[model samples]
Target chain A: MKRLVQALRNVERHYLLLLAPLLVFVVAIAIYPLLFSVSISFFKYRLTDPTQTKTFLGLANYITAFQDEQVRKALANTLVFVFGTVTTELTVGLGLALLLSAETRLMQFIRSWLLMPMAIPPLVVGLVWRSLYNVDFGVIPYYLKLLGFDLGRGPLGESATAMAAVILVDLWEWSPLLMVIFLAGLKSLPSEPYEAARVDGANRWQRFIHITLPLLQPVFLVGLLLRTMQSFKVFDIIYATTAGGPGTTTTVLNYHIYTVGMTFFNMGYAAALANILLVVVAILSILYVMVLEQRQL
Target chain B: MHRKSSRLAFLALLMILALLATQCAAPPAQQPAAPAAPAGEEASQAPAAAEKPFAGTELVLASMTDQYVAAFQYLIPLFEEETGIKVTLDPLGYVDLYQKLTADFVGHTGNYDLMTVDIVWTGEYAANGYTLPLDDFMERDKDQLALDDIMPVSWTLGEWEGKHWAYPLAGYANVLNYRKDVFAEKGLEPPKTQEQLLEYAKMLNDPENDFYGIALLGAKGPAVAQDYMVFVQQHGSSILDENGKPAINTPKNVEILEFFGKLFDYAPPGATDYWWDQRETAFRSGKVAMMEGWSIARAGYENPEISSVVGKVDIALAPVAEGMEPKYGFGGWGIGINADSENAEAAWEFIKWLTSPEIQKEWIRHDGAPIRRSTLEDPELNQEYPWFPVLLESFEKGDGDYRPRIPEYSIIQDALGTTVNAYLVGEMTAQEALDQAQAQVEAALK
Candidate 1:
């Protein structure tokens, strides 16, 4: 009993022992699922069939994914969504952050109100936007017609515009997160460089280009990495609104994975698709981290 | 200082343990007091109720959120009163219910004692041993249940591999719902043939007035697949050939697809994006003159809150091919005991009580879809639901198994749904889409 108490005392005194529970939790929840998913990707398993055992297929699932046209289309759509939402969000978010940089009463109020859209759950955002895009009773289409815009079955109903409509919903829900990040970045920026630029006869635009943007490179990379990763995994909005409809124009990679895994019960193939998504996200994250590190140096 | 900090840490741990102990002890005291009085009263009145074979047993039911399930909640208290079994109802959305049920069954968690199974899932569930056969239970309680009173079509829903896996709860017959007023003005009879229906559609189509002739399901996934099956069956073609092989690209199927494409021109402009709710909304909002809908939605057409076409609509069996006999689509839910359930006997008792003829009669009064032939024939029920007779006729003639009940139905649905949607959106011709679907479905089946 004395020896047991001494061992306990030693662990308590280490301080790092306090983190053991959290470490175990992370390993159990995160690392285990990741490893399990990777292992499942190497098999041919269908959840629906009880008689069939999981057959080991090596990299056959991955090879099939590369050859699958639907998967390729979904990958292309995912890239388009990530590029479209990230670029537009960064541009608009930077502008809003710049405008709200002024320390004033109304700007403060507007800054707080900008976060309302972000507060809404993504599924609810999808549902609300779906109603707003409805052709018959939707407020947007009604007013667009009144304003003489030829919508032609509304944006979501047409193959040509469904992707754009979905991107717009993502923009509405997520742009505010970028704006908040950029606002903090702008405030934390050194004013000494701007003062020096002005002394050198640099105008506001020149100062912003040379001084502000250079200083904000790390922040920009962080925002890009976060938004890019999120946009690639887009599912709930497409699910609630378009359901990958209008000829599969809005079927992003995550939605495709869901359909393969849940809808079709192709668990092994779905795991392969998921691992591919993880690789893409990891590469993007590493690239962003490298750029940020370079900027820090 | 080190000694004092260690003492503080020890005291905090003691406090947390004490708090948890208090919480663990609280529930039992609160639970027993509420049921004691009624239990005592019932004990004196009915010895069986007092003895309670399954007393303290709790049964959890996973169900899809429907009007019937909502009304069924009232009976839970009575069940608890008589059987001394606590019932927990977990109602989820249709898709979510299937996913949850699948996960629970696959994991063998025994989380759900009962599940409301879709008829289409009977084969998959039974083959996987996810559901228990109810034949033994039925035989034991034969006289009490009166299994013969259920509609024959309803009985077929529960039978897979020559055994009963579930008891029918709700049965729907797919019907063509049309604007009666529009048909009257055009001097049109409800068309009995697909060709006549298309001709009538062309005549009634008025885009300027925001009235489309038909509201076809063009949404990708199960919506389009289900709607397409109705047409495929009507054309005297099956998804699988006579040899039970993929025959989705048959000449008859191709003809139907081409005809469906032509019909799409007269449907609402965004019809390709519509699902079940959207299609029903199109009809109820008076945007479309006609649509193929299930019998379940017929009651909603007269509800003043959401419907603008009240008293202006009529129902009929879906039109068949020119020379073919008429057949309607059949679909609905059934309740089954989970094979992994620990309280199977208690769950079986609950199922018996829920499906009893007396409860079923009362059930229909509160928006429940009927599965019993006797309920449809009851004069009082007929007076309330005038469409019951038509529903019964459709039930007798309808083919419930039009959509294959195989384990591969989901994969087949995905392949065909995507192809059909592509054709509807003009991404491919009917032949190309059907060919592609045939190849994909055959590959999936293999």
Candidate 2:
């Protein structure tokens, strides 16, 4: 027993040695910058200043962020985008996974084909959609005009429709990912539950409602968390399509942070805003972990 | 249990890193996939290899993907042959070029040895010392540069507070381009004043037939802001007060904003989102009766491949507000050496060679804008481009400071970009828009 324990300890030490490089990589790229961002949030710094001066202004940047109307509007916009994309993606993705989960050859081919959009870069997707949405010389507008829909300023050029248009683009690109995830969940679900439900005189609809959904709770949680996080960070789509235009209707939190950091070069305020976003994401992640832990129990 | 817990922690760490990457990894502006290779293989056959003082020095030029980029492509090979200095051209879009150059400057990367500086960036570049001041180079090369031959107004390309931060490379004058056939059919002359221009637009607008009165840039951000400033310049109103403070929300400017909005009534339904490219498209495709734009595009309107209205377009001086002095808008690119560049002399030599009067003619032929008075008056160029006379007149009376080339210009631009767009899209009234802009600019300045 003593010899076995010594061998196990040696194995564990080797495992730690292997993990050290990854840990160092993570610290350099992720943890260090995160800490730096948190530290800078309390200062007043402009990247464009020749002297690269930093004056301490503890909590002033955060206070200004709360009071700034642009920040508030961007936060609201981001929340709306997150909610819109996540819920719609989950529902549509669930439907697609169910319908396409059959093991037939055609079904497999169609499933692979549907995932094509996910393979293309989001920037390219946004640019292609932007052209399709153009008012004068675009296919969508031409067809919409024929169908008798009065599209004022087309879809992306109007304040009322811009956010919805952006959401639709995200849905087109990302719903396939959720579909694939839910499909894996569906495949792994035990057949015993459905068989028992049917044996108790449960119909297909009833079986799905009572057994499938209940069993898929963990998968739903995972999909929701993953998509909600991603939707909060939407930038490339808005940048390519609307550029937060038509009177700042589509500007999200990330894009606003970009404007501050990159455009204005107000690094301190941008860092504060980024930290706020990080905290929001962290809270969501913690809630996710707690729920996941309870489910395992 | 310990292994499982460690695995979970690792997964959590990965998630956070993924999120951080999204925030930090700013998408690098798309650069040309391949840098140009040096084409000077005949270095040994040169008049004298000893005379090539900067031979084998490599320079990278970051240029806006404007029409003049074609000129760069055409001229660089010849420059490489003559001076034995190899130049790699990196063409980028407008926003990308600005952001990339700023990042390079701020990081002191010394990535681009030379870059094309926009007129509006002069004050910012000078204030930050991002570019080497060219006054010394100009003085040393005064004999070769033909300093007096360059148009006086063109000096604004990179001049700030009596110092030259960049040498004038291309000069563009704002001029009116209208369909001659359409004007004749309507029996109307070119509008000579702002009021007459509006009246003509109203008369020419035929939306039912998929045609519009004029193509104007109404898109948010720099597009609309610059277009509105063009009208403000025409009205003889300044973006700055007499004391050189931002006076964008003045009563006179508010009236000008309303006038600008009114003109949009006759524009295309989708004009609200048109960028410079789209506006150019609308005019080139013959869907618009008139357009007020840079003289650089005038030649493109005659090219059959790109223009639908070839041989049917006419040029006129951009109309000014009635009773206002006729000061046209002048703006274009200036080539500047990066302050951190190690090959500053070689880069300056390239600039001298590119802007020489002899090469300026070839540059003009290949879609480059003219900065030299001699190039504008060259008999061959005059014969080739019939619109040179109007351009010369407009450049002589150009107002390069209309857009306010101050260090804080971008701040004002962003404010006006949002609010003017807000006003145009009916989210805010003209008064409220300008007022908000004023507040934003004031806050930023503080």
Docking level for model 2: acceptable
Q: How many backbone clashes does candidate 1 have?
A: 0
Summarize candidate 1's per-residue lDDT along B312-426 as a digit string, tens digits.
9999878888888777788888889887786777888888988888888877876778888889899998998888888999898878888887766777788888889888887
Tens digits of per-residue lDDT for model 2, A86-146: 9999999999999999999999999999999999999999999988998877789989999
Pick out the ten consecutive residues of candidate 2 chain B with the lowest summed lDDT. B31-40
TM-score of chain B as predicted in candidate 1: 0.86
Q: Which lDDT tens digits does candidate 2 get at residues B1-446?
A: 66665565555555555566555753333321221112122223335446888899999999999999999999999999998999999999998999999989877789999999999999998888888888777765689889999999999999999888889999999999999999999899999999999999999999889899999987888999999999999988988999989988999999999999999889987888889998999999999999999999898988999999998999999999999878999999899988878788789889999999999999999999999899998889999998999999999998899999988888888888888988888899999999999999999888
lDDT of 2 at B121: 93
The i-RMS of candidate 1 is 10.7
Worst 10 residues of 2 chain A by lDDT: A3-12
Global local distance difference test of model 2: 0.88
